[model samples]
Target: MAVRPILIFPDRHLSQPARTVQYFGPKLDTLIQDLMDTLRSTPGVGLAAPQIGVMERVSVIDFSRMKKKLKPAPCQDVRVLINPILLSGSGIQVPREGCLSIPDLLANVRRYEEVRVRIQDQMGAELILTASGFEALALQHEMDHLDGKLFIDRVLNLKTDVFRRKT
Candidate 1:
C-alpha cells in the first residue's frame, strides 16, 4: 500500500462522477489500502477514490481521531465504502466542513444529521450503515465525492460561509 497524491480542487477528476466498482479483486484492494494510507498521511476524516485521481466508486473513512475529542466518542473505526448509495437521510446539520482536496478552506455545508447508506465493504460484502452526528456527516461527505461533488459546492455563500483556516 502506498500513500497516493490527493487530487486538489480544479482537478477534473474531482468534478467527475466515479465509476462503480464492478469487481472485488486485487485492484480494488489496492485502491482501498491506498486510500487509507492517504487519509492517514493527511489531515482529514475521509477520502474518496476520485480524490486520489482514481475514478472508481471507492472511499475510506477513519473517524477515530475526530471522535476521540468528544466526551462520548461516536465510533473508533476505519471504514471502506465501495459503490456507496445513500438509502435514506433525515434531519440537518450544517457543521463547518473542510476537505483535504480543498486544502485550508473551511465552509458551512448543510448535511444530513443522520443517514442510512448501503455500500460494499473492502471484502465486497454489502451492508447498510446507519449513522448520526459526526459519523453521519462524514459518511455524507465521502458519498458526495462519488457523485462528483465537494463540500464547497454546497456552501451557500462564499463570503460568509467559507473562510480560510488559521495556520
Candidate 2:
C-alpha cells in the first residue's frame, strides 16, 4: 500500500459525498491500508477516503498513541470503518478540531460526547460499538467526511470559532 495525497480544503472532492463501499476484497483492503499509511505520515488520528479523493465511504482511525495518556483509548488498534453510520449519540462536546485536509485551521466544532456507530470492518462484518471522549469526537469527525462535510461547516460563527493554527 502507498500513502496517497490528501485532498485539500476547497478541493471539489472534499466537498462531494462519498459513495458507499459496495464490495470488499483486495481493492478495499488496499484503500484501507493506504489510509492508515497516510494517517500515520501525518499528525492526525483519523482519516476518511473522501479526504484522499477516493469518494468512498471508508475511514481509518488509530488511537494507540494516546493509550498511555488516556486510560481507555478509543482505538487500541487501527480500526477500519466502511460505510459506517452513526446509530445513537448523547451528551455534547465541542473540542477544538483540525483536519489534515484543512491543514492550517482549527475550529471548535460541536460533537456528541458519546456515540454508538454501526460499521463494516475491513472484512465486511458488521459490528456496533460505543465510544466516548476523544474517541467519540474522532468518530464523528471522520464520519462527517463521508457526507462531504468539514469541521468548519459545523462552526456556528466562522469569524469566532475558527482560528489558524501556528505553522
Candidate 3:
C-alpha cells in the first residue's frame, strides 16, 4: 500500500457519489491500508476512498491523532468502514473543520453529536457501532464524501460560516 494523492476540491471526481464495494479481496485490503496510511500521514481524523480518487464506498478513520487537535476522544482504533450506512444520528454540533483535500481552509460544518452506522469490515463482515462527540462528527463528515457531498455543502451560510486556516 502507498500514500496516494488526495483529490483537491473542485475535482470532478470528488463530486461524484462512490460506487458500492461489491467485491472484497486483496485489492480491498490494499485500499484500506492506503487510506489508513494517507490519514496517518496527515493531521486529519478520517479519509474516504473518493478522497483518494477511488470511487468506492469505503473509508478509514483513526481518532487517535485528533486527541491533540480537538478534545480527548474515546475512539482510538483505526477503523475501516465499507459500504457504511448511517443508521441513526442524535443531537448536533457545528465544529470548525479542515480537510486534507481542501487544504487551505477551515469551515463550520453541522454534524451529528452521536451516530450509529452499519458497515462492513475488510473481511466483508457486517458490523454496527455507535459513536459520539468527535468520533461521531468525523464519521458523518467522511460519509458525506460517499454521497459526493462536502462540508461546504452543509454550511448554513458560506459568507459567515466559512473560515481560512490561520497557519
lDDT of the candidates, in the order given: 0.87, 0.87, 0.86
Give, for candidate 1, the lowest lDDT window spanning 10 residues: 67-76
Clashing pairs in 3: none
Ranking of models by TM-score: 2, 1, 3
lDDT of 3 by residue, 47-161 (tens): 9999999999999988776654444455557888899999999998888877788888888888888889999988889989788878888888888989999888888898999
Q: Compose the digit string of candidate 1's lDDT tens values, residues 31-124.
A: 8889988899987889999998999999888878574332344445888889989999999888888899998899999988888999887778
Q: Model 1 scores what on Cα lDDT?
A: 0.87
Candidate 3 residue spans exceeding 4 A from truth: 68-76
**How well is each residue in 1-167 modelled by candidate 2, as lDDT tens digits?**
79899889899988889999989999998998899999999878889998888999999888774433323765557778899999999998888888999999999998998999999988889999788888888889989999999999899999899999998
Candidate 2: deviation at residue 111, Å? 0.5
TM-score of 2: 0.94
Ranking by lDDT: 2, 1, 3
The residue pairs found clashing in candidate 1 are: none
Error of 3 at 126 (Å): 0.9
